[model samples]
Target: NLAALMRIKRRELLLILLVASQFGCIALGLVWGASWLHKWLAQSFELRALAEAHATTQQVAVRLTRDGTKNFEPGTAGWERLQSLCERTTVPYDGHLWALRRDTGALICHPNLHEDPSLLRYSLGRLPIVSSGRAPTLLEAINDAEANDEEIASGTIIVDGALQLASAVSLPGTNTVLLILQPYAHIAQAATDFIAPLEQIGWIFSFGVVGATTVLTVVLINRYEDTLAQSNAELERKVQRRTQSLLSTRNAVIFALAKLAESRDKDTGEHLGRIRSYVTILAGELARSHKEITHQYVAELAIASSLHDVGKVGIPDSVLLKPSRLTAAERRAMQLHTQLGAECLASIQKQLGDDDFLELAREIAYSHHEHWDGSGYPCGLQGRQIPLPARIVALADVYDALTSARPYKRPMSHAAAREWIASRYGSQFDPEVVEAFIGREAEFRRISEARFGSAASECDDSESTADSPANEEAIAAIAAGI
Candidate 1:
């Protein structure tokens, strides 16, 4: 039960993991895809806010350069006025970089000159020269933003030992560019902050959903398993009771069969074994030709056939063992033994109350000696009228009798016995039954040897002989083999 429970839990865990993985993958995909879309949308908002600062830079450059502002002498008042215009812009203090330059690419005035040695001398060669429109990045993300070219475009750099996004600007009336470096720590932190809430919610939703579903599924499976376990336990108990009854029934059948054999042959050492072995072989042969019944029926047929001569218990021993020919009355008395076997089986049936047992016994005791030509005694069942089980046992009994010497006759050789069986085909035996036997001659020979041969074979037939002295082996004891 522990192992079974573990297996069930493992299976459930695997299913839960699969479901969780599916949901998790979907949620992660959705969150990341939305984040990309959001960044695209936010770029438009940034462009609007920075538009004026970009126009101011570009317009002033056009005004100064187009009117020959470059010809203004040094220390000229107009140069000072232009420089004031450059410094007087309302751009964010850190958001814009202001610088004035000549067409020769020489810097005229720059903001925060002493901030750093390279700050004023920052080169513009690598920056794209957009025509007063912004781009997403100078390294090229969005290049066709016509109006945006006048505003900031993005670029990265290490300034003052810190990573920054540096946007370059063309100075008024000059090819020189101004570099504005914004530290990226704030932007990167802001991006992380934006996704943090979603991460928290994602974990909470995923863990909660998975945990709840796993618990619910486990509870339902537990209920089903508990019910199955209870049902199987009850079934096991019922099977135990039935098994006890069957064991008792089996024992009774064994006792009766042994008693029948014991009453017949006193010297037979393994009589039960010999008779059951013969019937089993014949029954097995019959099983192959008859395809309708389950293979299990052969075992029942063997058991029932073992008790065929049980009726001999009712016959007087004087007639049953007579060394000489019996009178007509004695013959009749001997035939009555068949009825006695049937009667005994009927009595057992009443006690056991089993229909199958009665049917098998009826076939064995009543029709084992019945012939194909209606010459056999008792009911004189002929041809197909004789049950296949009885016919098989009949052949086996006669074969064994012919080979094993009895008080009435010396044992015949196997060849002689075979010849006698062949001759008796239609009169004393069913023609079809005889044919089946002839066809299964090798098997029949094997069965005979197994039944009455040696330890070297299936049975210890060689240890027993008809000439062996009587040892008082009971009929019931020997019949048990059947």
Candidate 2:
């Protein structure tokens, strides 16, 4: 239960982390968008400021020329008028208005001329361009504008020892150049002021959406998992019940079919039961030494072993119930029972499609009589060439036939049967199966005695004294008796 709970907790944690990561990506995307927007706004504001500065310069030029003569002497009426106009006309941002001689780039009027007396000696043409790359200086731009008869020239220039944007226009009929200049930092500040508040609002909105989405997603995941677990548990219980019912029905059908074949002969006497029990004992013992034999293998073999002699139903009563040894023809006819049983099981398997019990039954029915030395059956299958299941059932079948009374011969004691099986190992039966039989011989006796009760005890009584070593002649006598 703790492990299951831990697994659920782990899944929830992973989902939550995935949600958090998605939000992080969204936040990153928003930041990238905001950065692009900030740059766009900055460029827009810078362009607007430059355009306004150029227009103001043009108007100042028109106004200056309206007075008719360029009498720019300091303290004169024309000079005062020029200074008043320069001081009154404002540029966008923290900008200034100044006038320069168009032909020579000499400073004529400036807001700072009175404050700094050296400003009068400042020449736009003589000032060193403070820049990092090749660009048009203010004096060069103004000269180009005058030569081209253009009204405006605007570019970056140094003012008061700092970088500033300058827009200049030459008076139409005079040597005066009215210029508007503003610092670059002012344009960037204006753009930032426009976008910062909006970014703050967007961040708050995104966080709210992300938080709400995470909560809703977690709740849905929990509810869905609970419903799915309940459905799965109920389905599992139903499947288990159905599987058990199918197994019971299958085993009953197999046992009934085996009984049908056993009913044709009266002397066999619970032979199928003893065969199934013997196979189970041998399979269980072999499983300890054989990696291929498993508990399922043992159980399936126990069920399938009963069908080994089912073909006896097809044999005529003359051959099947004969009270004495048969001729070679009748013996061959008797061996045909294995082929008949295999064909019967094969036909059934075809109808049943793929099934483990039917498959095992068919193999054992066909090959159970096959000898390890390739001498005993419908097919002369050699050692280890026989299927393992058939090999196991072969040993089991022989041991049961030897210990049980038959119309042809009296039953041998458990010791005699075991000795015969051990002697035939590697020649008539698989050595490994014989070893397993030897290891579980006591269980074999118990199953045999239990099946026949006092009748089996009476059979063992006659052989108890004769359980000594049997020579080749004695072994031949026993074989002839069978």
Candidate 3:
């Protein structure tokens, strides 16, 4: 018994050491990852700042040169515009643009100089330039560049006691140099904001893993011989639980992202939920006839259907949320959502490795607008050229849009929507999917009524009569990708 206890104690000591090593490794990894991420972010910001400065400087030069101005005369429109551009602070990064006379280092345009006219006489060269190499002053650099006949120069500059990334270019036919300055502190702050959440998540994950492992090891040591079989069973259950937890987390994140994209349009009103429900009905009905529409396929299709309009997030608010019929150009732009959504999902799939669900989502997002008669906006995929999931989602999406109210139009009655689907059977929809819809018409009506109130709520909610001209016009608008 003593020997057995000693063995258990030794095992506990080993487990503790293992946990300590894991904790050390996790800590080191977190620190290294954070440092690398910050460095990368800083570099990206620096490049962006330099590019903006260079572009703005060239633009000022062009404007000045275009007006046939030999010098930045104080009263000229070109001079005023240059001053305005310099005074305008850049967003998110908080940078500045200013101009200086190359010959005397006279401040020509700056927010501070504009605000305090006295500062206009102050020389930019006197501000001091500092870098890792203890770089010479801007005046020295400008003199050096003039000596070399160079048009542009870059270095670190100190302004208002803050170190900034600086880009400077000589204005053509003028003794002026345009300078753009971006503070390093702002870049570091942005990088910190971006990386803080990741750091927090890493700490939580590491702590959870370490704590769980320690507790499990203690439990095993306490009941090794008596509960060895039970412990093995418990471990299997734990693994299954963890796997299920991961799946739930993934699904939640996906649905939340889809919902976020859908929320941009105010009239969508439970659009995702209704689409998911509608797809389930259609896919389930079709599953009876198509062998590929298995249980797993139906489940995935329902979730994937919610992402059918995820590409709408990339569309401009003017086009996406417009309350009227789209112009030809706007319609074309709206149609690009298919490509955009497909690309978005494709990028995610590439990062996460191959995922069957994401592949299905991408397929549906890309081709849900396709018509059966080879007339879809994006690919014009006809018949089986369109994936089964996309076809299922297409019917579901149209039906939901018809039944749901939008700012541009009233909702169609269930009977009208049903007849509309029936009319588009061969040309716009898969005949098999249409047949499935026909078989499950009752279920569709039930879901619509439950989610969106009774179809009879509309004054023209008749089952047999032809749709009015106004309703047809609204249908046309919907068909235009409203």
Top model number, TM-score: 3
Considering TM-score, where higher is better, how would the candidates rank from best to worst?
Answer: 3, 2, 1
For all candidates, the clash counts are 23, 0, 0
For residues 1-482, what per-residue lDDT tens digits would candidate 2 score against the true structure? Answer: 99788968887897779778878987898899889998999889878998999888878767777758676666677777888887788888889898887667788888767777688787775454433364666677767777988677776777667778777877666667788888888888898899999888888888888888888877887778778778999999999989989988988988898898888888778888888888988888878878978898889889998898888879888987776556778777877888899999999989989888888899899898788888777778988789889998888777777776654456777877888888888988898888888888889988877766777767667774344343333334333322
Instruction: Tell me the deviation in Å of residue 103 in model 3.
Output: 43
Q: Each candidate's lDDT (Cα)? A: 0.59, 0.79, 0.81
Model 2 per-residue lDDT at 106: 81
Per-residue lDDT for 293-404 in model 1, tens only? 4556766676666677778777777877666556768878878877888887788788868779577877788778777777676787777888877877777777766555
TM-score of each: 0.43, 0.48, 0.51
Candidate 3 off by > 4 Å: 1-239, 451-470, 480-482
Backbone clashes, candidate 3: 0
Q: Candidate 2: misplaced stretches above 4 Å?
A: 1-240, 451-461, 464-482
lDDT of 3 by residue, 30-136 (tens): 99999999899888877776777777777767766776766565777767877777677453367777788877778888876656888776677656675447678
Sorting all predicted structures by lDDT, with the top scorer first, yields 3, 2, 1
Per-residue error for 379 in candidate 3, Å, reads 0.8
Displacement of residue 319 (Cα, Å) in model 1 is: 1.1
Q: What TM-score should be assigned to candidate 2?
A: 0.48
